[model samples]
Target: MKKSIVLISLIGLMIACSGEKKESTEETQITEEEVQNIEQSAQEIDAVIDSSIQEIDTLQNEIDDLLKDI
Candidate 1:
């Protein structure tokens, strides 16, 4: 009877461990997907920043040219 109890306890522990592992794997997958989405959004924002900088530089050059004419 004692041996059977021990065996049952071990089986229960194994099942619990497996469940925890599956849950952890699912969480990791979700985190990776979120990271990828954030990276893509950051890249889009960088592109917008680059475009704005170019426009500002062009305006600065035009202002400099007008000053030279004065």
Candidate 2:
């Protein structure tokens, strides 16, 4: 019957859709080496930013001292 065929097709479609959902929910594992590499890169970036800020502060102080003399 047409009704039975339609019902079976819908059930098949639902199963296919549910399999895709499970695949999407599965998490990708990160290795310990990958985590360590990420941490090291972050620390390097922080060090560079801190050094640049210190340099800017030093230059600003020199400019202020010159302006005071003027």
Candidate 3:
């Protein structure tokens, strides 16, 4: 009958849609974890840059003192 065919088609459609929803949720979770890891790495790099700048400033000051003595 036409009614049975339509019912079966609806069931199939629902099952297919449900599968897509799960896949989307899993992908979102993976993206969020990656974003968090990237943020942590960025923070670590910023700290290293700050430390390097401080070291350069100290060396420059020492050089200026030597020049003053000369």
TM for every model, in the order presented, reads 0.54, 0.61, 0.55
Among these predictions, the greatest lDDT belongs to 2
lDDT of each: 0.90, 0.95, 0.90
- Ranked by TM-score, the better of candidates 1 and 2 is 2
Q: How close is candidate 2 to the true structure, as a TM-score?
A: 0.61
Instruction: State each model's C-alpha RMSD to the native.
Output: 11.8, 6.5, 11.9
Rank the candidate models, highest TM-score first.
Answer: 2, 3, 1
Off by over 4 Å in 1: 1-30
Please, what are the lDDT tens digits per residue for candidate 1 over residues 8-41?
Answer: 9999999888863434444434678899999999
Residue 17, candidate 3: alpha-carbon lDDT = 84
- Backbone clash total for model 2 is 0
Q: For candidate 3, lDDT tens digit of each residue in 1-70?
A: 9999999999999988886343444443467879999999999999999999999999999999999999
Put down candidate 2 lDDT per residue, 1-70, tens digits, no spaces. 9999999999999988886344576789999999999999999999999999999999999999999999
Query: Model 1: which residue pairs collide?
Result: none
